[model samples]
Target: MSSFEPKIVTFLCNWCSYGAADLAGVSRFQYPPNMRVIRVPCSGRISPKMILAALRKGADGVWISGCHPGDCHYIEGNYYARRKFTLLKEMLEFNGIEPGRLHFSWISSAEGVKFAEVANKVIDEVRQLGPAKVFIKESPEESAA
Candidate 1:
């Protein structure tokens, strides 16, 4: 439907992407209000289960942003995230989920504009796909009501 607005779950690295997001807000950059952000110490700390959990919990899309290559405060954390993300993408495909519903980016703390741009891009791509069908799990609270 033309009125569809997808819900996105976002994971951002504390030292980089999160800072960029904060800066984006401070700079008055306007982007779609579709994301629910979860800040982590490093993108490398994000487990595949967490992404899957987000999907299962009714997130229409998921985005992960981290430090640029060679700039992880934790040293090599972003590299680890990059490698894990590659494998995770394949896994999502194997499970019948469109990998396009998932997005990833490398962003520096100083890149506020870039953060807004990527946020808009991710939202547009997910909106085009409409709502996700698979991987949605009803929680106990939902079942109770």
Candidate 2:
């Protein structure tokens, strides 16, 4: 097959990671255009269902980025996010999702360079995994046929 370009679903905490992504853009840092970002009020708001939905919708990978521990604008939000991410990641892996298909990170608005770096890393890893197979939802017509 031709070279694969994986589709990525990215969840960014509005106060931190989202700002960092915007900063990376303004700084002209280059990264792959493979990600579709969803901005959330805080990382703590992310649910396992959301991640699964992305995968089911045919995303090859998913990434969640939020404020560093102890630095959440919502005060303790990232703490909750950390625990949820840990457990959800493990569960997804146990359920047959490849370990490399999910990623998590902490990035502040001033860390534009770091944001670019992480973006590149995430894209590279997912590309290596090729197209997603499991849990992908077929279109209605395709399924009906």
Q: Return the top candidate by TM-score.
A: 1
Residue pairs clashing in model 2 are none
List ranges where model 2 is wrong by over 4 Å. 136-145
lDDT of 2 by residue, 1-145 (tens): 2588899999999999999999999999999999999999999999877887789888999999999988999999888988998998898788888889999999998899999999999999989888887664556755676
Model 2 poorest 10 in a row by lDDT = 134-143
What's the CA error at residue 83 for candidate 2, in Å?
0.8
TM-scores of the models, in the given order?
0.92, 0.91
Q: Report the backbone clash tally of model 1.
A: 0
Count of residue pairs whose backbone atoms collide, per candidate: 0, 0
Q: Write the per-residue lDDT of candidate 1 for residues 81-139, one digit (tens) a residue.
A: 88988998998889889989989999999999999999999999999999999755566
Candidate 2 TM-score to native: 0.91
